[model samples]
Target: MRIAATLRMALRALRRNKMRSMLTALGIIIGVGAVIAMVGIGNGAKSQVEAQIASLGQNVVLVFAGNWSSGGVRSGWGGAGTMTVDDALAISREVPGVINVSPEVRDRQQIQANGLNWNTQILGEGPDYLDIREWPLQDGAMFTDQDVRGTTKVCIVGKTIVTQLFPNEGPVGKSLRIRDIPFKVLGVLSPKGLSVMGSDQDDVVIIPYTSEMKRVSKRTNLSSISVQSSSPEFSDIVQRGISDLLRQRHRLGANRDDDFTIRGQQEIADAATATTRIMTVLLGAIASVSLIVGGIGIMNIMLVSVTERTREIGIRMAVGAHGRDILLQFLIEAITLSSLGGVIGIVLGVGSAKLLSAIAGWPTLVSVTSVVLAFLFSAAVGVFFGFYPARKASNLDPIDALRYE
Candidate 1:
């Protein structure tokens, strides 16, 4: 028989048992849908984490002012102010590929403005801090280098500060009191939603590090330093240069650990995204088990079909249908069922992802690659599980098959 006739016969056979065929395809449909939905959720989470990491700005590196270890005591970074203003200046002056640097100090204070008082984070940073962070001013201008040098009482405010402290008035050109000392608001920072640590990014005020050390916080040492490289390719070089310069300046010997820790943008991003990547793979693996179960269902159903049609197979073989033709007919039926299921499952999966995103407020991203892979895998499952039953039907002796009924 011709290939076309065999395919037609196979399809016709399936149509004769529409309820059974539909029930058999359900397993594949559920399997494909689950895989796509789980993978989409995973990819969405990874993308969100990467976006947050990118918000730290391009080619950025951080220098935290604390030691990782002190003779095996193992005190991690950010314990105390081990870095100085002079250290930040030396990095900007001496380090190659370093384009921008910001000495940092951190504190929390109840700031008052416009007869409204709110407790927010206070940051001591350089004039180049916004530039290094790639953060733009929503209103007015950034405090200049002169402000840092003069230890001026000028400040920048985040959106949350504006909302809390200067709700009815323009924050720029306004005065906000930090630690009972008033500072002129120079600019309003563009709103940043949240940090990777899930803290509000915009609930802060920024002032010159000089003013922070000399006036408000009254500390000589810095909390940390933020650095920006000239380009992405130069980030590693800049990081290395800063490490070496700081080590030499601090006079740490080869056997002794440094007093500061340095982290580049790529390293931070990798660390942040590692959890999401693992979740993606784990979800995908769990969902794949359903596809295996679906394939088994197809195998079991095909074996039953071959048994029920054993006499029919004998009649066909006796008439002149080749064994290969018999095999092709059964194989086509299985493929038709699985391929049809795959197509429907693709639709179901995409719909489920969108629905989840809309209703549950979850981030979901369905990639074309995933859809294509699911479809192809489903079709391959048909071939793999369909072959045995097809081969058994084709190999039956016509005389014995005819006598069995």
Candidate 2:
């Protein structure tokens, strides 16, 4: 009953200065809201990046052709033609846990079909390329292994190619010219949107690597190789096997550096998401400063309230109220202000996140964990900041407080 009465008195005192109480709580409200919104934005971006990484397919490993340096000059991955189709064949034949392999030859070319020409990426890939990428055909079927072996003039078109060159008609069973040589369109690939690098994924054509090497571009070396492991658990083993096999095939000694670069799906994902993770921490830290400021504001207001209510404290003490009771009353008031602000802040933060998503078209994810943490932190700030003022009010001499003008 005493605790209930003390809480009621605390609430009544707050009601007497509604504007001041609200102003004091405004800092906490903004702080919690900012933390929630910023974290949501960061998490959303991280999720998007992970989704993009996942689009590369599960248990996927990538081998880029070049990473050699000589005479103070360095060649980045895919910059040198150190990898060959024979190396790719060796990996497929010899590497354990390897389920699929595709030697890649990448280029950009202008192609014509139905009196329309569109410049698009020309990707020379193996028969298992679609399987390795987990990509599906929207129409017809992928070219067979026989097509790759025979260097057949057959290809699969991406969505952009279909839209640009085969508008008003299906592209399957149609012919498009690459470098004035006619190639049959065997399939239309399902849309894949943009890649992690923000490049349009569905803006290319895929053909047999042999056909690209023998007929067009005349490149003797493979650009890169895509490998898929039997399962995610076997990805690391597959990568190690591939690295060793490639090193042996290229005749690199123990002392010599690797000429090729190897990366697994998980590695790629971690690297891609690292920036967003840092950004999340940075944004949260910056927003937390406001909460501290709000705490200070609460402390200042409580101190002033204690001074203004000194005479009330003396009267209550003379009437048999204990020092602990006076302390509880002020502490409860501070906690009520902070807890109320926290609730409102949560609402404001969620609404703002949704509004930003709708208006700015940026993704936002407000997780339950962030909301709970913000509220708990706000309440903690109240206790931390409100203690000193309440303690001082309780410690004041009753006679002196009563004599104060």
Candidate 3:
């Protein structure tokens, strides 16, 4: 009965000062809202980064030409001095963990089909390139080994190339000219969206590696070689095996350093993930400061409230209310104010997350854990800030409080 009476008195006091009560609650509202928004944004960014990494393909390794520096500052691009077709073949024959290998030479040139012309990247690779990269054909077949060996004038186009050059007709058996050199279209790749590096995967043309090296670019050196591992677990082993083979094939002396780099898909994914996570944490920490400021505001307002309600406290005490009863009354009011704010903030946070995901076309996952954490933290702030003021009100001398003007 005493508890019920105290609660009734607390509610009545809040009702008497409607504007003050609302203003006090607003601090908690902003605090909880900020926390929810920050966490949601962080989670959304993480999901986007992971999705982009997954799109590259699983259990894949990319080996490029040029030397890399382990210490001091170096240029962004690094590779062996030269990677030849023979190097790719040797890796395939000698590397135990390598499942498949595809040597490639790339050049950006203007390609024309009929009267339509557009600039696109041209990649020269064997049939195994499509199989190893998991690139599916939309139409026609991939080039055969015979096509590469004979340097056949056959090409495979990406979905973007097909859409740009052959809008009305299928690309299969069509002839596209790359710098006045005509090549028969053997296949077209399905759309594979843009890579994390901002390069369009479906905006290029692919031809037999031999054809591009000998007939198109006429270069003797390979740009890069892509190798697929049998399993994700064997990726490291395959990477090291390829590195050792390249060192041996290149004939690097014992005291001399290697002039090549072997990179695994897992390493790229890890670096991307780590960078994204750090960015998210940094942003979230900055946003959390807003919550702290809001908490301080709550504490300031609650202190003013206790001073303003001193006479009320004296009246309740004179009417047989104990110090504990007064303490419970104020604490309950504080908790109610904070709890209401938490609910409103949760609704706002969820709505904002959904809106961002829809607008940006990125993935956002709002977990139950985030909602619970926000709510709990808001309540904790109320309790922490409300305690001092509540204690002061409870400790007030009834006679002195009542006599105050």
Off by over 4 Å in 1: 1-5, 68-76
Per-residue lDDT over 1-405 for candidate 2, one digit per residue giving the tens place of the 0 to 100 score: 277887788889999999998998898999889989999999999999999999998789999987777898987777667899999999999999999999999998999999999898999999999999999999999988899999999999999999999889998998999999899999999999989889999999999999999988998999899999999999989989989998888889999988888999999999999999999999889989998898899999999999999999999888877888888888988988887778888888889989999999989999999999999999999889999999999998999989877
| Total backbone collisions for each predicted model | 0, 0, 5
Q: Pick the winner on lDDT between candidates 2 and 3.
A: 2
> For residues 1-405, could you state the per-residue lDDT of candidate 1 as single tens digits?
787887889889999999989888988898888889999999999899998998898899999987555556776666645689899999999999988999999989899988889999999999888888889999999888999999999999999999888878898887999988999998999998998889999999999999988999888998899999999999889989999998898888999777888899899999989999999889988888888888888889999999999999999989987899889999988888888888888899899999999999999998999999999999998999899999999999999877766
Q: What is the C-alpha lDDT of each candidate?
A: 0.90, 0.91, 0.81
lDDT of 1: 0.90
lDDT of 3 by residue, 1-92 (tens): 36677667767877888887777767667666666766777777777777677777667799888765556644444444467889999989
Tell me the lDDT of model 2 at 208. Answer: 97
Best by lDDT: 2
Question: What is the full ranking by lDDT, best candidate first?
Answer: 2, 1, 3
Task: Show the colliding residue pairs in model 1.
Answer: none
